[model samples]
Target: MNHAGPSPVPSIFPQFFAPGNGPTDFIVQDFAVVMIVAAMMMAITYKLKQPMVIGYILAGIVIGPFTPPFSLIKEADTLNVLAELGIIMLLFVIGTEFPMARLRTMGKISFAVAIVESTGTLLIVFFAAQALGFSFFDSLFLSLALSITSTVVTIKVLEDLGWIKSKSSTLVLGMLIVEDIFVVTALAVLQSFAAGGGEFSLPGLAVSLGVTGAFIAGVLVLGSRYIPRIIDRAGKTNDYALLLIVILGLAFGLSFLSTGIGLSSAIGAFLAGVLVAESNSAAVARILTLPLRDMFAAIFFVSIGALMNVSLVPMFIIPAAILILTSFASKLLIITGVLVRAKFDNVTALRAGFGMSTARGELSLVVVKGGQDVGAVSSTILPLLGVITVVTTFLAPYVIRFGNKITLTETKKSDGSSNMEESSSGVG
Candidate 1:
C-alpha cells in the first residue's frame, strides 16, 4: 500500500486456461488411467484366452467409482462422451460390413424371428416382473429392457470366433438389425409415456413411429444416392484424413438427425454405414477407419463396465439371476423355434439363437434410465439389470462356442439317422 510494488506478473495462460491445472487436465488424467489399466487388464485377459471386451470392462471396474480404493474418473461426462463416440464408430464399422444383398435375402426370416423372439420375451418378462410384485408400468419397462439383444457383444464374439460369415451370422445380424429398428420405436413410446407422467398416449406413439419411419425412408432414399457419389470423390483423392472426415461427417450427421427425431443415434450411424457401403469406396473407407473404430469400441465396453454399481448387486441378486435365466432361455428357444418355422435348418437356427441370447446391453440400460427418469421403476432395477448384463456378457462367448458344437453334433446325428432309414428302405 505504501510504496508502488512491482505489478503482479500475469500468467501466460489464465486460471481457466492453464494446460495442466484445469478441468481438462483432470479429464486427461482420467483417460490416461483408464488406458493404462485397460492395457494391463487386456494383457491378463489375453493370456486367459478371454475376449478383449471382457478385459476392457474389467479395467473399468477396477477404476470405476463402484470399486474400492478411489474413483479414477473425476469427469464421468467426458468418459461418457468417449464411450458414445465409440458406439457410433462401432456401429458405423458394422454398417460398412453389412451387405444389403444378404439383408434382402434374409429379410423375411429375420423379421419373423425378430418379431416372435422380441414379442415372446416381452410377454414372458412382463408377467414374471408382475409376479415379482412390479407394477404394470414397471413391468412393461423391464420387459422392454430385457427383450433386446446386445448387438455389440454378440457381434464381437461372433467375429472373434471367425463365425461372422457363417450362415447363422447372417440371420443373427439380420435379426439384430430388425431389433434395432423395433427398439427405437419402443423407446419412442417409452419417452412419450415418461413425458406424459406415466400416461401413454397412443396418438403420440403413432406420431413418433410415423416420424421415425419417414426419417429412415428419407435417409435411405436420399443418402443412398448422394453419399456414394461423395465417398467416390473422396476416395479418388486418396487423402485418408479427408475420407475419414467425410465418413464421420455422414455418420455423426445422420446420427444427430436421428436423435433430433426421437430415435437412436446408433440407428442413424448404422444406416449411414449401409449407405456408404453402397459406394465403390467402402473398402478403402473401412480400411482407413479400422484403427479409429477399434479404439472407440474398446472405450465403449470399458465405459459400460464403469457404470456398474457392484454394491447394489447384492440387493437384487436373486431377481437378477431369475431375469437372466429367463431372458437367455426364452430368447434362445423362441428365436430358434421361429427360425426353424421359417425353414432354416436346425443347426443354423440354434446357432443364431445362441448368438442372439446374449445380454441386452445398451438398449436395456437405456430403458432402465428412461424408467428412472419417469419414476416408473425403482432405482434398484438399474443395478439389477447391470449385474444381469455383466453375467450374460461373460457367459456369451462360452455359450456361442459350445452351442455351435452341440448343434453340429445334433445335426450330424440327424443326418446319420436319415441315411440309415434311406438305406433300410432301399434294401426293402
Candidate 2:
C-alpha cells in the first residue's frame, strides 16, 4: 500500500485569515456580530414582553448598510444568499406544521373566513395604493403584502396569553392555515406572471394559475404516496443522522426542482415539507428540523430588516400609514362579519378578528421581498412593508389581549346573569 506519507500533521491553528473556498474571515466575523447583536436585541425584547421578531429586525437595521454608525456587513451578496436559504427553511417548516387535518376539522367556515378577510383586505389596500399614485404592479404587490397575516406572531401571542387552546384561537389558527394556502398559491401565480413580464394579460394569468395549480396537485398527490415511505424507512433505521440528512435532501432537492420548473424555491421547499408532514415520521422530522429552522428564520427576518432603507420611511409614511389602517380595519371587520355570518357568536367573532388582524410580519416581508427580487414592485415597497411589519408586530400582543379581556368580561356577565336567574327561581 503506497503509504500516503503519514498525513502531514494538520496545522492546529487552521487558516482563519487565508483565502479559501469557504466564506472569508470577514464573512465569519460579520456573522458572529450579527448573532451577538441579534441575541442582545432578542434578550431585551424578551425582557420587555415583546416579540423577538422586532428585536431581530432592529438588529439587522442596526448592522445594515442603510443605518448610521457605519455598516457592519462588507458584502450583502453572501448575506442575501443566506437570507434566501433562511426563507426556504422557514417556509419548509411552515409546510411541515401545516394543519391539513385540522383544516378539515374546522370545515369550510374557516376557509370562508380566510377568503373573505384576505380578499377584502387586498382589494381595499390595492385601491388605496392606486389612489396614492402607486403603479398597478406596486398596488397589486402592496395589496398582497398587506393581505396576509403573520402566523408566527399570532401563535406566539396565543401561547403567551395561554389562549392557544381557546375556541377563538382554534378558529383563528384554522383561518390562518387557509390564508397561508391562498397566499402561497397566489405567490406562485404572481411569480409566473412576473416571469411573463409583469403585465396584466388575462390569458397569461390563467396559464400561470393553471400550471401552478397542476404542479401543486401533482406534488401533493405523488409526494404523499411516496415521500412518507422513505421517511418511514429512514425512521426504521433508528439513525437520526441519516433521517436528518434525508429530510434536508428532500427540502433542497424539491426546492431546486421547483426553480428549474420556473417556480419560486419557496413553493418547492414548502411542498417538500407538506409531503414530509404526511409521513408517520413527521414529528421526528420536525424535531430534527426545529433548531435549523429557527436559526435560518431569524436570518431571514434580519435580512428583511437589513434590506429596508429606514430613511425612506419618511417618504412612504403616508402610504404605510394608509396601508396599516386599511389592512387592520379591513381584516378585523371582514373576518368578524364572516364569522358572525358563519354562526359564531359576536364575542368569538370579535376575538378571532382581533387575533388575526395584526402582525403581518414574516409572510408580508417574504411577499414584498419576492416582488422586489422579480422587479415587479418598487424598491420602496420593502421599507414600507418593514414599517408596517414592525408596527403591527409590536401591537399584536396588545390587540389580542384587548380582545381576550372583552370576551372575559362578557363571559363573566353572562355567568352572573345565569346565577341571578337560578337564585330568583329558588327564591320563588
Candidate 3:
C-alpha cells in the first residue's frame, strides 16, 4: 500500500474564503449556506407546529457551537449588515401595512398598557436582580436589556399571522415602539452615565436628547411632504420605480448621522421607517425590496445564529435561567396588559403574550453592542446577553404557536378583524 502524505481537506470555515473568492463573494457563500439551512429549518418548524421565527433561531443554535455542527462561522460583520437590513425592512414593512391613523386610534390602550407593562417590568426586573445579589449596575443593565422585546421579531411574527389590523396587534406594535423609544433613551442615559464615571448629568445629557429630538422633528416635518414627490418622480422608470437606492442612501445616511451625534444607528433606522411611512413610497419601497430583503433576511437570521457564543450557556447557568424567566414574564405582562383591556379573551391575551416574548433582534443588540463600544457594560455581559437572546428568540415562536392555536379555536369566527392586509408586495 502506498503511504499517502497527510490528506489535505478544505475546512468549512476557510473554504468559505479561499483564493479567487473575494471576501464579499465568500460572505455571500456563507450567507447562502446559513439562509438555506435556516429556511429549511423554518419549513420543518412549520411542519412540526412551531413559529418560523423560532425555527430560524433554532437552526442557528443547532449549527452554532453548542450542537452537532459546532460550526466555525465567518463574515460576521457582513452578516450584521444584512441583519440590520432585515430590521429596516421589518420596520418599513410594518409601516406599509398599518397607517398612522390606525396606530393613533389604538392610542389610549397602547399608551396605558405600554406604560404599565414597561414601567412595571423594569421595576420588577431591576428589584429582582438586586434581590438576587447582582451589582447595581448589573441589575440595571440586565433589567434594561431584558425588559425590551425585539420590534424586528414582534412585528414579523404579527405580520406573518396577518394580525396587524387587529386592535391587539396594533396595540402590540405601539407597545413595541414605546419599548424601543424607552430603550433608546435608556441606552443614551447609560452611555452618558458610564462616560462620566457612574454619574449622570441631566444638563449635559440634554444635548444628546436635543440632537435626537431635532433629527426626528426634521424627518417627520420634511419627509411627509418631500418623500411623496420623490416617490412620484422615481416611479417614472423601472430603475427609478424601485427607488431603493434612495431609500438605502437615506437610511444609511441617517444611521451614520445619528451615530455622529452620539445616539445609535438603529434610532436612525427607526426614524427612517417613520419618515418613509408618510409617503405613498411605503408600498413602492416594499415592492422594490421583496426579493432582496427576503434573501438577505434569511442570511441575517443565520448569521445571528452563527454569532452566538453557545459556549456561555454552559457557564452562566443560573443567571441565564433567571434572565430568561424575568424576560419572559416581563414581556408576557406587557403584552397581556395591552390585549386584556382590549377585551381579548384570556386565550388571545396569552397568545399575544407569546408572540411578543422573543427578545433581542436588531435594536436590543444595538443597545448592548453600543454599550460595549462605548464602555458601558463589562465584557462578560456581552456573552451573557447573547446567550439570553438566543434562548428567547427560539422560544417566542413556540409560545406564539400555542397561543395561536387556542386563539384561533376560540376566536376564529368571533373576529375576522384581526387579519391585517398583506403586502401586495408579496407576503404570500
- List per-prediction Cα lDDT, in the order shown: 0.75, 0.82, 0.63
Model 3 alpha-carbon drift over 4 Å, by segment: 1-29, 58-71, 74-103, 130-141, 150-170, 184-198, 238-242, 331-362, 379-383, 390-428
Q: Can you write out model 3's per-residue Cα lDDT over 217-327, one digit (the tens) per residue? A: 676677667765676566556575358877766667766776677766666665666656556666777677567666655555555555455555567777878878886
Please give the RMSD of candidate 3 to the true structure.
8.0
TM values, all candidates: 0.81, 0.89, 0.73
Which is better, 1 or 2, measured by TM-score?
2
lDDT (Cα) of model 1 = 0.75
Q: lDDT (0-100) at residue 109 of candidate 3?
A: 64
Q: After superposition, how far is residue 226 of candidate 2 from its true place, in Å?
A: 0.7
RMSD of 1: 8.0
Which of 1 and 3 is the better model by TM-score?
A: 1
Name the weakest run of 10 consecutive residues (lDDT summed) in model 3. 1-10
- Look at candidate 1 and give me any clashing residue pairs: none
